[model samples]
Target: MASRSSSAAAIGRAARSSGLPRRNRRRVRRLCNMAGPDLMKTKLYSVSPPVKAKATNASLSGPTRYSPGMSTSRGRASRHKKTFPVPPAPREFQQARSRATYERILAAALELYAEQGFHATQTPDIAERAGMSVGGLYRYFRDKHQIFRELVHRGLEQNRQAQDRMLAAAEAGLVAGETDLHRAIEGVVDWTWKALHPTPPDLLRTLAAMAYLDPAFAELTEQYDRYERKALSRLLAKLTSRKRVPSPLAAARLLDLVVPNVGIWTALHPDEARGVKEATVEMIYRYLADPPE
Candidate 1:
């Protein structure tokens, strides 16, 4: 009986000691659960605590430097050449958007041609100014010369129109108290001034200089001069009486020499050519009214 009791007491003591460790372990698990997922995972795994924390941090931290193969904010690279954008044409035309295109091209060409000489003014430069391709410019004009010809024609036509108005005003009795001869001379001078004063003085100068080089240019210039002379001659013929009527050819030649030559001089040497206007009208008056002694 004594031996059996002693064995039972030994067993009871072993159970109490084991139950104490299990109760302590359960309490530890409860505390870890209260501390949150991080603590719970750290406690559940016998891992080095910091190693588990670091792994958890990495997993929860979204994308960052350590992420696999991340993309950056830099722009895409292109394979083709970089091209410039073409600008809109300077002038707009209603009748011929195409005609407007041509005029815009011619306008730009004339500006460049005046600023820089004909040889220097390339179609590419003009095309750049017009905001078009060189190929597109060719569709409108065959060559630079062709464009020049048209520009001159347009300018001359504009001058002719203004002359027509002046003549009408004269016939309606609006002269500035001058003789019919002086009135005719005044018309010529006024038209010449308007022509010379256009935006680019160089264009007309270049045209005149080019005439010496190119026969076609020479012919074109002659046509314009002939138109001027013809207009003057017609005016003189209308104004002069049967007896005093000066020769139309002579009068035209004289007026042409007086007015255009003055413009040419002024264009060539703007500094030396002041008072051209008043001086020209005075000279014309003296040449016409007071014959050379």
Candidate 2:
């Protein structure tokens, strides 16, 4: 803890001496502090693999970032919209042993979901991975779906927090040092690509399958989209020079839908990723930046 604080303070001092615009410098200091250590490795927005049957591993790196801005408006509005069918964990998390058991189950489930996809990963598989009996697992979770639901919630929340941080940074006037639309889009693609890295293809496919079984999962997705679209719309309005945009809300919707799938797809098939990455950037850039009819 002391070392981490010292590192943040050192970065803060460096920013103070740097010739960057005062506002920009201040933003940098804030980001460094928010990120704590390993600033460069931390992505602008690290979206977990598409709802991972795994939805997401809550262990994704770096601290969550958000600020007072358009990025959080809809997020705040839809925060309470979804209701879980099962309690995330019926066990008391306050006890050390109980908390450890709960986390073990989740970690085990996340691994199995990645390896086998959501449907194929049974309670037994999770219990085996967690080194617990099936009956033991049930004491913490009523069923596997409940565990899945909890993971999806954690993953989505993590992704949302990262997205808000990225947008907030952008809104704070950090543009990845690009002014042109295509370059900006490329940078965006690159950042997302790095963040996604790789996720099992089967996990990517499981999002739809899981959504069917649990309407709550679908509801959570809808809620996220609503918040994401609004935030993206605000970003488009601010960044674009043209007075008229090609339905900024529509464009945001497209990105909010497309980016995760595209990311996961590319991660599993790196040979095809370059083409997909370019295509995604072009499609999104035109959708967001092109002049209105």
Candidate 3:
């Protein structure tokens, strides 16, 4: 009975040893199946090396190395970081723009000065109305008077242009030998009267005020008045010579009556000038249009 028992024990031990290898092989096969087809196509009993912690961390630290889905997210972040470019300014401009700006500023200042009167209108007010800096305004003009001087110069030039045209027309009539001296006198009177009446009332008043306010300005005013008289006297002389009108000097003096009186009356009493303008025009007409007896 002891011998039989020993043989049975040896057989049992061999069966146990044989079954252990088969069970381990089946576990490895299932693991390869879970790893997918790439692992399956390789050696069925193959064993890979264990991953090192340092190598895994080094891969994560590098720029290119990333997890399965993380590479796409990082690429998107890189694309978003790119910046858009900006545009540049122009290289050059002309002095014409500056001249235009100056003219605009001057016009705005004049219109404001005319509306409010010079003393009441401020430089800052002019700058604001002109859409310019007050500092910039001073750079161009020293004071309101300087700006006024420019305005006066411009106005005088405009007046001179108009007078030239009118004189041309008058001279043409003379060359045609316009026979009726009375009709010619009436035509001259009308033309001269219209020209005098068109001077801006506020600018004229401001000039008159300057004579009383500033002695230096009063001298400048005298010079301009002299220039005006000379111009008028020259033109009147031409008119008198053309007509062969008798007492030519006296007739020229009569022609000069409208301007000085209007200016003087306006300076002394502005309200009175409105009334005198019409009356004076009539008076001059009567004197000039009448035939010498």
Name the best candidate (by TM-score): 2
Off by over 4 Å in 3: 1-93, 179-189, 196-200, 215-224, 238-254, 260-282, 289-293
Q: lDDT tens digits, residues 1-293, model 3?
A: 55445534433344344433555445555554455545434464343322222211111112233432244555445433322122122224368787777787788878886777777777788888889999988867766655665665565455556766765666677678762444555555555556555556676676567567744444444544454455545545555544444565555555555555565555456567656666665665465454566
Give stretches of model 2 more than 4 Å off.
1-92, 174-184, 212-214, 241-246, 290-293
CA lDDT of every candidate: 0.60, 0.67, 0.55
RMSD of each: 31.8, 23.0, 34.7
What's the TM-score of each model vs. the native?
0.58, 0.61, 0.51
TM match of model 2 to true structure: 0.61
Q: How many angstroms is residue 277 displaced in model 1 relative to the true structure, after the best TM-score fit?
A: 2.1
Q: Give the number of the best model, judged by lDDT.
A: 2
Better of 2 and 3 by lDDT: 2
Question: In model 3, how large is the Cα lDDT of residue 73?
Answer: 54
lDDT of 2: 0.67
Candidate 3 — which pairs collide?
none
lDDT of 3: 0.55
